[model samples]
Target: MRVQLKHPARLALALAFGFITASAAAAQEPTPEPQPAPAPAPEPAPAPEEPAPQDPAPEKCEVVIDAAGVPINAEPVTVKASFSRDIGQPARAQVASESGVRVLSAEPDAETPLTFTLTLDTSAGNAGDWAIALEGEGGACEGTISVLPASAPPSR
Candidate 1:
């Protein structure tokens, strides 16, 4: 059938009819089947963050020396050294100073004050100080010793 819009009244009627027809067709188009709300799109999972690295524990040790006098002028002084904990066996042991000196020997003991013998540098003059540093698996520790020239003879 042919539809024609001739008069104003007919044109209005034709426009209304076309609009209603389009709406009816859209409404009848299967009602969209009542979809299940699309399951909320499954909310994408969050990405995992990388973990941070850790540092190793610090080691600890101690060193000490004992002598007849603060200023070790004598030939030999009993040296003692220890660690924060047991170091299994002796670690690197040495006696050092700005003045030349030497360690006779190191004797290890189960406890602190591991005794040793230190011989002063024959060439070292009076009034020089040196540090005794002991290092091992545990770590390191330092102590100080002084060298002094023999006292002057009795005053007149």
Candidate 2:
């Protein structure tokens, strides 16, 4: 025997069946392929470059005699000289004395505030004025040194 349903129940059943049919139909249809995400907008071009700042020109190299004219004897005499710029190499100090004063050693100091030392052999030289000449790669200085005569010994 056929079963009889109430009008409300029949209506509810028909709606449920319709929804299920629609869902099945949607599932059977082919889905569109996902598109790649849009490429990120290109970065703005970099700003134009500016020229770098330049350094000031270097000062002309020079040498100056700070002090001289020390008394000469068997001992060594020291003369001090300064350079406006680094000599980069040791300078040559030449001592020319009318009485034959000779330069025993000439050497530049190690660090900045550049300086030189000149040791003179006064034993061979007589009492007179000595010409001091300092020559370097970039500069030179000229000066004079004086030597005093040996004092006479007291009579016994």
Candidate 3:
């Protein structure tokens, strides 16, 4: 079929058709969806704990030399010492000599004074100064002992 129309009328009709097609397509299309909010930031982890500090060791006991008995012949020498702190019952005593003096016996006098007997080894040349030590639950102590020459006479 053939239809005749003027140039201006053809242009107007074409423009109207294009406008109607664009409006129908826009109405039929679906609307865009909204986006969800971002997740909350995670909390930081806690720090580790440190250990507590320790205390220092206690000080050693004090000992004072009161008197020392004479060393005569082959007999043992006696030493008396006073303790600064009270050592409980069943205290321990020891002797250390520079010239080979040996401890023969030791005893604690109730509380304060501690007595010890040191045997002079004439064969090993134990005729000089010696050191005595005493220890117990309370604390510890140290003292000294002196011996005369073998040729010297006993004078205590």
In terms of lDDT, the best-performing candidate is 2
lDDT, candidate 2, 5-27, per-residue tens: 76988989989999999999999
lDDT of 3 by residue, 74-129 (tens): 65555556656655542666546455555555566545444333233433435566
The regions of model 3 sitting more than 4 angstroms off are 1-57, 68-72, 89-91, 110-125, 151-156
| Sliding window of 10 residues with minimal summed lDDT for model 2 | 63-72
**Residue 134, model 3: Cα distance from true site in angstroms:** 1.3
lDDT of each: 0.56, 0.70, 0.59
TM-scores for every candidate against the unseen true structure:
0.44, 0.46, 0.44
What is candidate 1's lDDT per residue for 1-114, written digit by digit as tens? 997566999888888999999999998887555656555567778989767657656554455555533343445544455445444444655556454555655566545444
